[model samples]
Target: VESLSFFPAIWKGITETADALRLTVTGLSTLFKGVDLKETVSGPARIADMLGTTAVQSFSESFRTGIINMFSFLAYISISLFIMNLLPVPILDGGLILFALIELVTRKKIPPKVLYYIQFIGLAFIIALFCIGFSGDVAYFFNNFRGIQK
Candidate 1:
């Protein structure tokens, strides 16, 4: 019961951090002039010329589209966060509920060792997932850069 109380705090912190990041990116976008950071950043003028448009117009439209898309992207991200936080796995809210139900039925506290192991495994899995995603981002950047160079 005591452990379950922490889930709300954890979810709140994650949501706050995500919101902060979104705000920071939004702010930074306005600071740049005639530049589209999300558009590969490999000579925007050249790319715009190749695509048959002036650099300024292309950048302006890109920024506008990015701003519009961000709202929809945030909606999906919020949904994903809510769903993931509610999963029935250790170190998650559903997991806490499961533990509480077990304790209620069996009238025995789950051993601390087992709980610790479950959390450790979950943390490791999450770390591995992050690494994989980071690698994919790196690969995507390199691929896009190579394409632009050609």
Candidate 2:
């Protein structure tokens, strides 16, 4: 059966998604102007390490402390997901938004040829960022182990 709640629920999701995108865009703008881009972007490995650290801490702490640690970690993961999904690199929510915005302002759809080129560029950019972040994660891990070995 149809329900009014469905529309409101959709709107709520859209609203939260937009707010998350706005937050991420604000952070990126800081990077565009040379505000320590290296520290802003994080890779999958870095995220995994963070969760692993939290998991270890939870196990070693009191039940109350463990719960707090886990909940905080989960919150961080959720926010990360919200931001990541909105990134405007091809095949992502942000890319879709960008295309829609352009169509809205131009009052015409972009040609498939031009869109194809734009998408490829976005994809390349995303891959490059991933490579950089992955390397950073590797270095971070290496430094950690080196300290322990020494």
Candidate 3:
């Protein structure tokens, strides 16, 4: 009941703020672009372009920019993966740690039945979340492709 009551106000605030921010950001971006500054390309495109140009010129011209960007992205992803694995949640590295700690303290292993049930629930939840995210991604791509076609 409390959440239901708060939903409208919370949603309204978010919608209004997002709309205002989008407009302001878009206007600022256009203003900046009009000044003829260096154009920004997508990361993959930029990396490919750098590699292609450098490779054609000479092997000595190390594609420093692409290499640096790739390493930076890899580092960020690695850190994120580590952090996510460390989360104190079930069916993850954290869950294994939790079980180990329990065994150490209680001097008894968790029953196999309980462990199986916990893993089952966790797997179901993960599958549901994956489906939701995959559906959203597919819908977004389909809509964008349709718009491009028209």
* Weakest ten-residue segment in model 1 by summed lDDT: 40-49
Please write out the lDDT profile of model 2 over residues 44-67, one tens digit for every residue.
888888877887888787767777
Q: Distance from true position, residue 123, model 2, in Å?
A: 0.6
Which residue segments of model 1 deviate by more than 4 Å?
1-69
lDDT of each: 0.60, 0.76, 0.58
lDDT (tens digit, per residue) of candidate 3 on 80-135: 44655655566778777988899899999899999899878777865664565456
After TM-score superposition, what is the CA distance of residue 93 in candidate 2 from its true location, in Å? 0.8
Query: After aligning candidate 1 to the native by TM-score, how far in Å is the CA of 28 from where it should be?
Result: 32
The local lDDT score (0 to 100) that residue 90 gets in candidate 3 is: 66
For candidate 3, the lDDT comes to 0.58
Which consecutive 10 residues in model 3 have the weakest lDDT in total? Answer: 36-45
Q: Give candidate 1's error at residue 64 in angstroms.
A: 9.6
* Error of model 3, residue 30, in angstroms: 29
Those runs of model 3 whose alpha carbons end farther than 4 Å from true positions after fitting are 1-62
> What is the Å distance of residue 52 in model 1 from its true position?
22
